[model samples]
Target: MSARTTLRARWQRLAEPTLVRRSVVSVLLAFVLVWGVLLCYIFMTYKHTITNDPGLQKYGDALLVSLQDVTNPAHAAAAIDSTETWTYIRRRQIGIFPGKTLHALSDADGNPVFASHELKTLNLPPRHPEAVGVITEAIAEGTVYRIYTGHNARWALQVFEPKRTDAAFLAYNGRFILPYLLLAMPFVLVPVWLSVRNGLKPLQQLASRIARRNNDDLQPVGFDAQHRELKPLEQSLDTLLARMRQKVERERAFVQDAAHEIRTPLAVITAQAHVMARSQSEAERTQAQAHLEQAIARTSHLAQQLLDLAALDEAQRPTPRDLDVAQWLRAALAQAAPRAMARQIELSLDAPDSLTTRLDLPALESVVHNLLDNAVRYSLAGGTVAVGLRVDDGGTTLQLAVQDDGPGIPAAEQGKVFERFYRGPGHAASSGSHNDAGHATNGSGLGLAIVRQAALRMGGQVRLGQGLGGRGVGFFVEIPLAARRG
Candidate 1:
């Protein structure tokens, strides 16, 4: 690129405007421009008033009187220095510096008669009608002269500043003014820049605080700012941080509980495997291998329940749809048939297939499956697990109940059972399986918790009560009818 283009690009880069630069530059540029205009206005406003000055007027009047005696403008010029008319002016103590003053006379017809010695040397122009003073304008460049005219239309008397002295006078004044204008720039801009920077200091401090935080530090922001705007920002950030902290705590607690629950089964599995590996007799080895298989089955069951609970916590709720509760209960109970048979617990459903409402399919299915599993896991051999669906409250509400002949949750301990990883006093099992191959089962304590979560996700509530004939525990779920139409 050419030098001009290169310089232009560099200047453009430097001038790419930011908030601070625009604010400072706009303020300073406006101040300088306004001050410059003000100075120019005051300098020009009544400047011609200087021509009405008594000291300079006296010179023109005296010179005019001296020229009247000589009618021709040329005799007037010769008489000033060549004749005694010059001596008359010395007697009145009138001072005239020839280098600094000019004299000229012209007839009423506009013909020049006489002029001073320097009049021809000075090329001063005449004043136009719009010019503001008795003197022609003071020149700004080259050689400047103030041309003064005294005229009555019949005769004219003109005096000009002799050696462009106006240039020297203006130059002297400019030297005094220019430096001050240059100095004003920094004074105007520095304060503006500083004020803008200071105004954004709180935001800068907020950014620094955020940047310095540890990755796991989800605690609320703690900076106290003087600015009210930052208060809202701080509050919003703190709210999000508080939520994040809670989520992290929940995750930590969940991991601890899962590890504790899974540890027992894994230990049993490892011990049985070791026994099988070390056994000398064939029958002993076979028994140990059977125990290992049972441990493996229990471990798989525990892991599946853990995953189910985790998924419920993380799953986005599916859109609810109008669904037949009796139909869903039948389907869920059918899925639990194998486990129910393995435990020797009979599963049955009571209600017409027409009993229906709106709820999410997976969530409702999860709730029913957990309830059925709990019933089967805790019930006696050949015990009946009855699932029922009905319409309540003038048919505007749906009611679902799962009751069994299993050992029921006592009334006092019922509320606590829904808590995650909660194992009530009488809730222990002999072994850990729903299959016939394993003797007994100890639940992971997440079944009812999952049921409760699923119920809430479907916008319903669950109640704990006695089973048929008050023989065992029952979980009754109630749902709104409006949710279906909505």
Candidate 2:
């Protein structure tokens, strides 16, 4: 391949994604940019360095000293080699010749009165009269010279030296400086790769530590980072681990609680079934069968409650839309109104027309159903169980208050009501609120728990206070309006 083609191909590989390659290439590129600029500068100043040489400038001055001190212009020719200046120029052996006199001295009339034997052989043009300082000129193949010219009252002084000495000097620097730089390249590039690996040490350690962990270990990494870029990553891992650990603990506790809750009804069922099977008389069998049916019903209720909890735990809520909440609430109330009327309690719903808001319909439906059911079942005959929706915060929030004129719960018990399967004092058999036929309604005590969870999922809170002129309990739910999604 051509040299240019090879270099171009090598240049394109600098962009490869391997870290070691990038690091080594970057270091080499920086060195090349600086070295190229320095090479250009050295060649550009080659002439200046030669003309300004202390030795060359001093030799020229010494040769011209005689012309300046001569008593007459015509007699100045005798000053040639009089100060032994020619011997000084020849002693340096600067050019191709060891003893070449390479300049000519002339008068103001352009007549060469004293000329070096070698200088006359070139047959070159005379120096410009106005050119007063040192300059450079090309003499022949592979030959260049630094020419110095000066004048006094009588004679013009010229001194010349070949530039081979300057080339030799530049080459000297190239030989001593360049090769070591190339040889030391490994020292430079090796350190770059080492630094990249060193910078990534914390990350490698983090991965190994996590990979080696047992499945049950959900603890935070807890490792501090030395680099600023890694700190945020460390914190994020710690946060995720903390959340996972907490979730695991919650799941463990929930399984235990659910098992306990379901076990009681199931045990009752098994015992009642055995009793029904053992009964000999028809009347005794009928009575035992009734008990068995009730036990089965209770177990069924417990299973349904567990299913609801499971759904609430896993269901990803959809983005809320403009819901005619008033309409949905009325539809929800229609289902409860018949149940309330059976107990002679009035079920009433009040809201503005269409009352649009963002809400997950199923979750919100659960909240409505649970709160209203509790209200109707607990209220006294002929008492009012009112469901209401009030828009506030300039339409940014919607408040739902389910107020009933039942015997209100004590302030201390209000907080505990939202707990799973938690039943308050006088909330069961002794309470006036029961299903028709006056038998106490056997509840799983999950109604208000479901209500609280649903409210929280909607970014809201449930507050218990006085209802219906401070005569009974009021459960107030407040939720933020759902943000519009594109």
Over the stretch 68-101, how does candidate 1's per-residue lDDT look in tens digits? Answer: 6666656665754443244434533543222344
Candidate 2 lDDT over 1-486, as tens digits, reads 999999988878765577666777799997777566666677667656654663556666766775676756457766664433655565565433333436677877777877766665665446876766555465644456656677766678776665555556556556546776788788878888899888778888989988999999988887778889999998999999999998899789777877876787677778877877887788877887787788778768767766776777765876766778888888888888898888888887778767776687767877888887778777777889888887886767889999877777767776677777665555553364322112223477677777778887888888887788777888889888855221
Q: Which pairs of residues collide in candidate 2?
A: none
Clashes by residue pair, model 1: 73-113, 73-114, 74-113, 431-440, 431-441, 432-440, 432-441
TM-scores for candidates 1 onward, in order: 0.52, 0.60
Judge candidate 1 at residue 320 and give its lDDT: 71
Error of 1 at 4 (Å): 19
**Top candidate when judged by TM-score against the true structure:** 2
The candidate maximizing lDDT is 2
